[model samples]
Target: MKLNISDRKKKVINRMYKITLVIIGMVIVLFNDTFGRLEGFVEFLALYFILILITVAYWIFKQIKSIIQLKNEKEKTELLHLKSQVNPHFFFNTLNNLYGLMEKDSKAREMVLKLSDMMRYSIYEGDKEWVTIKEEVDYLKNYIELQDLRYHKKSDIQFSVQVVNFEVKVMPLLFIILVENAFKHGLENLEKNAYIHMNLSESNNTVNFEIENNFEIRHNSDHQGIGLKNLKRRLALVYPKKHTLTIDEANNKYKVALTIKIK
Candidate 1:
């Protein structure tokens, strides 16, 4: 049987009511006849009342815990749903750009075709909660290469992943999303000598990621785009209060740093 939360709560509530009524009856019966006559019975009833109170309190605590768990699960579901959209949106846009590249540059077309593997992973494996750091790093490399082919401008764009080891696992597409965002919003048609740098490191159970990009900073801006907003939302859902994230933008330079611990 599928037991809804309300049903289980009502059942607990009814049990509590029955216990309360029984205790009231016991108190009435104890006071009426056994007031000064019975010595031990009154003490026993008092102890029983204390036990009943304790049991009710325990049940209430458990109910509160269950409610908290439900809320967390709901938030996780929503975060995953949001994450699911990012890859396809990125793919369609990149593929359209790739189509334009195909018209004249056969080499660019061939390079863009390699993106299909990343697209496959984004569509299939990216759905999972976490993926190996090696996979994520490889994907980031391909993404950077794609941008390199598209940019047509050189010497300004520098990107690399600095890490000690590549065996650990992390939330898939987490760092990659930020890299994509840097290229999307920061790189402009007017700007020359734009630059982006990224580093990743892991020790024990903590993973650190830092990225900085030099862009044409527009005046009076709240933030960059939905991608960065989505990145923050994902971090919140996956890490909650356990992780640390910071972003700094000053004098036309943007930097983001994130530290996540796997427990």
Candidate 2:
């Protein structure tokens, strides 16, 4: 489902070539024939039928191929935009954390290396579409670990991860946004209980994701911020109507559940 730019271009070119071939062959059969016409209208009708069939076949193929290309281009464009937004937000958040750490702790320097690795994946790696679920899960774990370190004192954050299939691929940063959202409003103002629970399961060519966290009613003013709003956009663009997304906010608990079909 994730085709690179070059691959998409190649597919378009190949389809064009096939259309060209069909057209040339049709032209040859229609005009460059050796048969002399001493026949009735039925014979002419038969010839036209064959010609129309060939052209119609090619035309249908052309249309289908064009639709696929257009869809891919649209998806690619949207994903790149998501990556742009996500990379900056991620950098800003991480740098803010790092800045706070640098002000009082010397070990912040060591954590910078890990941050660099994360940045490498976000900024330089192949993030145009789906990445191996394993890679994304690992990235999520690293983020949670870093957040734990940042909130070492007076932070009661509980995080969990479950990866059922390493081979399955998912849209990049699909699950992490929920984690970030949970931390932003969940951990930032921890008065009673601050906890984040995440679970991922893959079966029947589907990915099940759930993230639940305690929500402080006070900080939930900006409920539809850039992150969650953009996340919904990304989900619509990537999964269309194939995936199911649910948000449950009740009893001071915020929960997000989405199931994506990988197949």
Candidate 3:
């Protein structure tokens, strides 16, 4: 892709600024000792050398800092791009479910309403880094309701939430991927005794989320895609040391537990 003109200019300007600092340091170090009398030259040389060392070190330090900052910004941008990519798959599945519902169910209208609320949230709020826990919890409920409509009450899915504070903010769509994964891989294939259980609870500024479901053994290529990886990457980007995600499977049942400390 072609770089934007403004971005190209900004890059050029940043390079020039760094180069200018380096050149200024070089000039100060090389020329300061040349313009002093011999008697004072030794003292001048000592002070000048110290000043030059400090100047060069400061410039190098700034250069290293700038490089790290740029690298982090680039990684953050790429992570956001990956997060954006996960949405299309979700939209595709939801629309397919809605299409199936429209053919026979009058409740499709209600489903559409719920889906529209989710669509609005995705379109407007998805781009944001953080949203209130209340907003995210509501989004999760709407999503579960939509999935319930699709499943036609065949699956035993339950979601419960206890919030100590609604004002806490968290990264948008952080937990939905696990819920979607549960539906897509675990509950969708089971013909009997299908179940999904989810809980979200907050205490002491930390949010705990858990989802578990059972599935029949089956091989599907699409199940191993980048959704979970993207979710992990987003968690790393947003929460870093303050988050933990664990997944366990046994007896044809899978569970995912995620904990995040709100900032």
Candidate 4:
């Protein structure tokens, strides 16, 4: 019966039952003189007992339904976690085979390894609330190296890091969007003398990242992209008042700076 009834239908039926019982009780109480006083009292007691039984039954049903729902959710979560594990293993195996086929000293082989490392980090560490700064820096370097391989033009790109403690942990993938945007909106549109400069530094529990790139003025647009919007939202959620993000665009150049205070 429970399986056949929808939640909405069950709720409606429950409400109707309550209303009917209430109306019946009111009618019985109002017509007490028509029946003997003792008989009226007996009827009232029976009705009250029935109402108590119904209430207890409903409470028991709700507890059982809650337990079943929780069990189903747990099973679904476990299945998804297993699938996630399988996918990364499959991906890495394929990459390994491809890597073996390439020449030892080939740029393609190097790119494949870098790509594999990036994929591994993204799959395993990207979702983590915090990761060592060193790991994030390595991921960024691999990403930059891959980008460098794809471009035919020799755009000047530089990344510098100054950190007192490499093991200091911060939110993962915090700076990749800015770096990606630098290439997407800045370096890609420029024809000559294109440059991207990035710097990351940490001091007094504060982490700062800055990136600047030159772009063609004709290719500039006034609208903010979704990536930046999402990044801003994430910053507001994760750091609240402890983070600052600033963007400056002028003279055919785009610059972004992000500062985060972490424990």
| Candidate no. 4 TM-score | 0.61
Q: Report the candidate with higher lDDT, 3 versus 4.
A: 3
Give all TM-scores, in the order shown. Answer: 0.70, 0.64, 0.71, 0.61
Q: What's the TM for model 3?
A: 0.71
Looking at candidate 1, the ten consecutive residues that score lowest on lDDT are 217-226
User: What is the number of backbone collisions in each predicted candidate, taken in the order shown?
Assistant: 0, 0, 0, 0
What would the per-residue lDDT of candidate 2 be over residues 1-263, giving only the tens digit for each residue? 99999999999999999999998677556654545533444476689899999999999999999999989868765654554334365567777888888878886886787677677667654455678888777777777777777666455555555556787877777776678888878876776567888887777788888988887888887654766766777777778887988999988899999898876
Per-candidate local distance difference test: 0.74, 0.75, 0.80, 0.78
The predicted structure with the larger lDDT, 1 or 3, is: 3
Q: lDDT at 120 for candidate 1?
A: 72
Candidate 1 wrong stretches, greater than 4 Å: 1-30, 33-72, 84-89, 219-225
* Candidate 1 residue-wise lDDT, 211-234, digit = tens: 887766563253456666777777
Q: What does candidate 4's lDDT look like per residue over 124-145, in tens digits?
A: 8876768998998998898787
Which scores greater on lDDT, model 1 or model 4?
A: 4
Q: Stretches of candidate 3 above 4 Å error?
A: 1-65, 68-78, 81-86, 96-104, 220-224
State which candidate has the highest lDDT. Answer: 3
Q: Model 2 reaches what TM-score against the true structure?
A: 0.64
Using TM-score as the measure, the top candidate is 3
Q: After superposition, how far is residue 156 of candidate 1 from its true place, in Å?
A: 2.4
Poorest 10 consecutive residues of model 2 by lDDT? 32-41
